[model samples]
Target: MSAVPDLNTAPTLDDFESLFVNNRDLDNVRAHLSKFNPIKTMRMARMEIRHSAILAWLLNPQETHGLGDKFLKAFISEALRGHPTAMHPSALQVSQADMMDTEVRREWRHIDILLLSPANKWIFVIENKFDSGQHTNQLARYLKLVQSSFSKDDFSHIRGIFLSLWDEDPDDDRYAPINYGSICEILEQQAVSGRHPLTAEVETFVKHYLEIIREATGMSEEQKELEKLARQLYRDHRRVLDFVIEHGKATDFSFACDSVFGEGLEHGNIVEVDNERFVFNNCDASSISFLPQSWHKALGGGKLYWNGCENWAMGFPITMWISLTVDADGTSGKIRLMSEVGPASDHEFRHDLINGIQNATKTNSRLRIKFQAGAADEGRKYSKIFKKNFFNVEDVQDQERIAELIKKALKDFRPEIDAIADILPKFASYGKFGKSGE
Candidate 1:
């Protein structure tokens, strides 16, 4: 049983039934709804399904499959009876039980769901909305927060998504460039088809934030592509604990004496870092170690490998490995870090930072770096390589060329961030996250 429909105040019971329960002709329903008032089309998502049972009944008119579907039934039964779960979640959280607050500068960080990879890369933020609207400053704030605390590992991939209702802008593309929209939808979009959980503006707003992340970072295509590849590799896993045990410190974190791939057995020379942090800080190798292997006896199964001279040892934690097509019998892609994990390792911050990565395979299949040479200086870089032996352009022209290069560099990061912003309006409602003006 459910509360009586407030047909006198809004659309009639017939409208609700046709739109959901006996929806054999959705396009016709949409067409009718559009012609009836037009405004109803945009406002329908704003209505919360207060009575899950009633909602379910609306979804299944004639007892179709005994109880219709379990998820829908469960969601409806609980809501109607007064128990609520994540399905009809209540997320007007003030602090970091959400992702909106993380990106804003100087705010005390409290990540809702923090993802830590064996390589130290993390998707540290997740935002939720009830509807889609033009995204607010929240998206930008999250990106800024990550940038502020970024390490080589932080750069591996900072993921932020809007789990909300539907898009505010009906005419715009409904997803981020990559499959980011799909990922967000997994968590935000409503079970009901056509009707999003949130609003369109919220999705657009989130996408705008992603654009900011991509352009501001100025990451190279090669690097961005590499990172994209690595994310795909680890998306479905549960835990990934690993360690370099030892690498150089931040002030002088550079290494690379020789080749770690010159011998006997093979999978090709593959270099992998936690996420793609080809850099590291000083650590007391003697004090560094793994999770004792026994701790995760039942989690899953992977592999391990290594190569290097006796003095400056090298090895791979099965948790930090990546599979490549070109790796026929152990030719390229092998990895080597410079250090040893012993009894006295650095423990100030148990995380790594990364930058300059991309996805070389499917949008879902990602690749990670096993290690970078101690000599790889992690710094801001320009994409195009100037091969000219000399510069003949006038000083002003050269200045403008440099400016154009800077602008072009900024343009590249847009794809990643924008991809994220595209899917934000499924779970949350309008006016959430304080509505940004810009």
Candidate 2:
């Protein structure tokens, strides 16, 4: 037998690096290293996650790992035909044969991605969305800009594309909808066909990008293996990885939230749920209690904690209380006025609340109350009095703006809340029916 290699010496850092990088297939290296690249790991204004990356890749044909014009051509073809596959050879020739220029966030209009053909004629406007909904009439504004720039006769088809992870109908019918699934399919075709053969290095990069797009579109397999591998790697290098993550840049939403709510939390006006969650407790409370873990499990995300008057439930067979919830999530922030009656045996309590609301409506027209009659088995009956979604979570305004709005909403509705709290327990117990003894 040949001499046995020494197994006792621990591997050096360089040796480990070589073990991971050397003699490995290019695709494997790319798949493993893509997430660590500066474009992904570093924070930059121009990079909006995958949004800017997609545009940059499309714009630069001579850059490393560049996808040739065929991908752009295929995308345009799909936009024109309103389907995945091209109609015929002639469909590809709808635009000029050559790509002249590409611009991102072009002057005042600030279009996301703009592709232009030579002779200042044909233009293709692409608006890409990953998880965000379109702003009010953004597509129409873009269309108007493009129409005003070039006359109808000067260009072939001044096509507007709404490229997204999922198919969404554009607000304006003038824009065409195309999803990443079609783009992935076209890239896969190019990879396999070898008509425009890509070098191995570029092929690996394209495959890495395709996988990301596929995962976003929900076309790829669940990333269990990758997740498992990542977990193991993190486990092995917990100290180093933890330090990196701790110092790493926070996302746009996270940074904005820190700027908006951080001080309020420090001052105790906002209560913390976790790093990502907080509730504005501007509601003056007589009682506060932690929500049971089981309740959280059953209710999922919307409800978090509970607060109400201390003696509101006294002298009633069923527990009844009036309260307001300061609830928030990524999409919206709201203050909800509510009255809950637990163990609702029949629908009579709801009818009583409804009658009381109608009576209250005559005196207080601003009060909008909804009675939700819950089955006994459903655990609780609730009457919603006031619900206003005031601010969007995406808009990163100053903390003062959000705090002021929250304070105003709570203050404006205070009289109504106080009125209902005083009347609800009394009205729910004996409003419709006579006293319990009688």
Candidate 3:
């Protein structure tokens, strides 16, 4: 062990150099993490749909993974372990469901994974969310859909499983919550138990997936060791690490956004209105959102409101954003440019703004844009007034491509952009009573 450095002194150049000098442990950590994971290489590790598909394959007894109902049984057993009705006859029946007759369906009626065993009268609804949150009362809506879709007399044993990467309480209490950690343990046990031998290819794939789950859920032993070493390094060179992080290069996502929008704005390639150019400050990495200077002024100088909701990068009354969104199948994603009106604090103003835009679109064919209508009584928390997909998923990896696509989209949508911008100031001038109070 080396002697501990004094905490009272500021970190010097020597302290920073020591981090890379003869740091075999640091080198080992780097080498260990360099191992390839296919799930990550394809960029499917965090996709909820991919996880659901894999689970459906593994859970089906007829599927070629060769676990033959072992994984399903274990998963159900874990889900029902601490349930209030775990010992109920229906719950027990579900735990011991005949896997041979079970049919796993993906995206059935918009559910992530639905396992139906008509012979055993058991149905399992698994709602998997990897990186997103439950929206629109989805859990409850799924339960209601399932109940209405299936005949009660035929399917008496119905179980709803909320599967996620993190621990979250399901909106519907009847739905049992299960995390990726449980899935990791289950996979580890079955893969290593040797009771049911998987083919070499299947074994490799399972191990790879298990590695992904463990790393995501913080269950990997190697990851734990890496974290331990990292903490020790940080403690030993706290000042140096802090200094580097504070003044280091921007994050990859942030860099990409800045490169794209910053250059576009500088070159006058971005959309403009009334000589007012759109501005995108590198405030968030996940999405590039901006508004014309005049529109920002109209919306109370772009003050954030509502703290935003799921899938939204920023909270503003109205703005245009280009964000990445996953496809319905979850196999890939795309970048979409959209104009959104977020829930503003002033309910009356928000209501008037939404109506003003909707009425404008209805009368002027040139300004027509498809969007979900807000309630007449009040404004919705979030609404996309205009949307268009501009680039494929792989294009996001290249900053130049992102910049090119964004420029094209701005030019293509200039008419709609200008029309919407013209309507904003009219609504902004009206106060709580929808009369000119400005």
The C-alpha local distance difference test score for the whole of candidate 2 amounts to 0.49
> Which residue ranges in model 1 land beyond 4 Å of their true spot?
1-114, 118-120, 132-135, 153-155, 168-438
Our model 3 lands, by Cα RMSD against the true structure, at 10.0
lDDT by residue for model 1 (29-83), tens: 3453344322232222222211112232323313332222322323222222321
Cα lDDT of model 2 by residue, 1-438, tens digit: 754433444445644454345523433535765654333343321223345455456554444544555566676767667434322223347544555343333333677677666443567777877666788988988978887886667664576778777888777666668887888888788664576777887776666666666656767664555556666665544554454455553443333334433522322233342222223322222112222122222322222211222133322222212222222312233322233443333455544544654467577767654444332223344443444423332222223444444445445555554455455544433322222322
Residue 306 error for model 3, in Å?
34
Error of 3 at 76 (Å): 1.7
| Residue-by-residue lDDT tens digits, candidate 3, 1-438 | 877877656778798788878887779877976788888776577766678888989989898988888888888878877777542335455566666878999999989999887887778889998877788788888878998999989888788888888898888888888899999888888875676788999999998999889889988888899999999988877877777776664533456566654533432134443344775533455566777655655644534233322134333467777766545544455667787677665677767777777776666776536667444356367767774435675424445555566666666777777677778767644323212222
Candidate closest to the true structure, highest lDDT: 3
lDDT over C-alpha atoms for residue 432 of model 1: 16
What TM-score would candidate 1 get against the native?
0.17
Worst lDDT run of 10 residues, candidate 3, spans 429-438
Where does candidate 1 have its weakest 10-residue lDDT segment? 251-260
Return whichever of 1 and 3 wins on TM-score.
3
